[model samples]
Target: MRVKCTVSYDGTGFSGFQIQPGQRTVQGEIERGLKKLHKGQEVKVFASGRTDAGVHAIGQVLHFDTEIYIPESRWPNALNSLLPEDVAIQAAAFIEEDFHARYHVRAKEYRYKVSRSEVRDVFSRNYAYHYPYKLDYVKMREAIKFLIGTHDFTSFCSAKTDKEDRIRTLYDIEFYEEDDVLTFRFVGDGFLYNMVRILVGTLINAGRGVLDPYRIPDILKARDRSLCGKTAPGSGLYLWKVYYDN
Candidate 1:
């Protein structure tokens, strides 16, 4: 039987979502938990997206094939008993055999957090980017408009990307502030490696007067990595949600 699971993890201690040869990863931990339930069998799991090291996820979706039978109500507790404190299985259910976590995903939402206060909060150090500069929220919002449709996101993607096609459709990009936190939310069909972080960095530069908001279009047209801002810290990024057609 195939099962779909919704997971949430505090990625502070994880290498990333995908399993590396010898590194600690969210997939490795979950696979171990599954192995505990199904003795002597290797479990394969698929995730909606692969998060970078130190990047967290609140609504990560995944699927796995297993022969062991466990009630959906007991799935969370069963997995939690064998998993680490930072990783939790929020829910699980029987899914169609054809359902795939990655291929079936319709859209994904990512939020980048920035601290606008002069004094940084120690508690939020792992969850937000502490910036001492005063940001112009209006200008940031204006800059985001240029990113709200399909475009060649080559400039925003890291040079290490292996994909040849750089075109991506951004459904929506918005900027808002609440208290001392400035939030940048991006919903897209898909994202390239480090795309969101680079986008946030560029927006930060615009907010800090380092880059003019009106130049956003020109930057996108340039398709040059050097013309964009630095990639924002992974600590400030979160995979907020993933939408599926079915």
Candidate 2:
């Protein structure tokens, strides 16, 4: 049977989602649990995408094939018993064998938080990016408008990306602030490696008056990674959700 699972994890204690040889990784841990459950047989798990080190997830999705049959409702508890405290199985169900967690994805949502308070919140230091400097939220919102819709996001992606096609569609970009915490919610068909972080960093530049909001269009047209701002820290990023066409 093919089992689809939704999971959440605190990326602080993990190297990343993918399995690394020696480093402690989310995939390695989960697979290890599955191996124990399967009586030493290897169970390969596939995820929707990879999260970089220090990135968290509220609704990450993955799927794996298993020979053992268990009630869908009890799968969580059974897996949780074997998994570590930082990683969790939120939900699990039997999915069609043809369904794919990665290829069948319809959209993804990523949320980034910034701490705007002058005095750093020690508790949230590991969860949010602390930028005490004042930001012109108005200019940042204006810059985001240029980034909406379909476009080649080469300038917003990492130079290490191997994907040749850089075209992607942004369904929406939501910016809001409450109690001095700034939130950026992005929904898109897909994202390139480090694309969202690079965009956030550039938007910060716009907020800082270092780059004019009107220049966003020019930057996109340039297709030059050097023209973009620095990539935001992975700690501030979260994989909020993954959508499927079900």
Candidate number achieving the greatest lDDT relative to the actual structure: 2
TM-score of 2: 0.98
Clashing pairs in 1: none
Write candidate 1's Cα lDDT for 14-76 as tens digits: 999999988999999999888878885779899998999999998999999988888988888
Which ranges in model 2 have alpha carbons more than 4 Å from their true place?
none
Residue 186 displacement in candidate 2 (angstroms): 0.5
- Which residue pairs come into collision in candidate 2? none
In terms of lDDT, the poorest run of 10 residues in model 2 is: 174-183
Per-model clash counts, in order, read 0, 0
What RMSD, rounded to one decimal, does every model reach? Answer: 1.0, 0.8
**lDDT value for candidate 1?**
0.91
- Candidate 2: count of backbone clashes, pairs at least 3 residues apart or interchain: 0
In model 1, the worst 10-residue window by lDDT is 132-141
Error of 1 at 81 (Å): 1.3
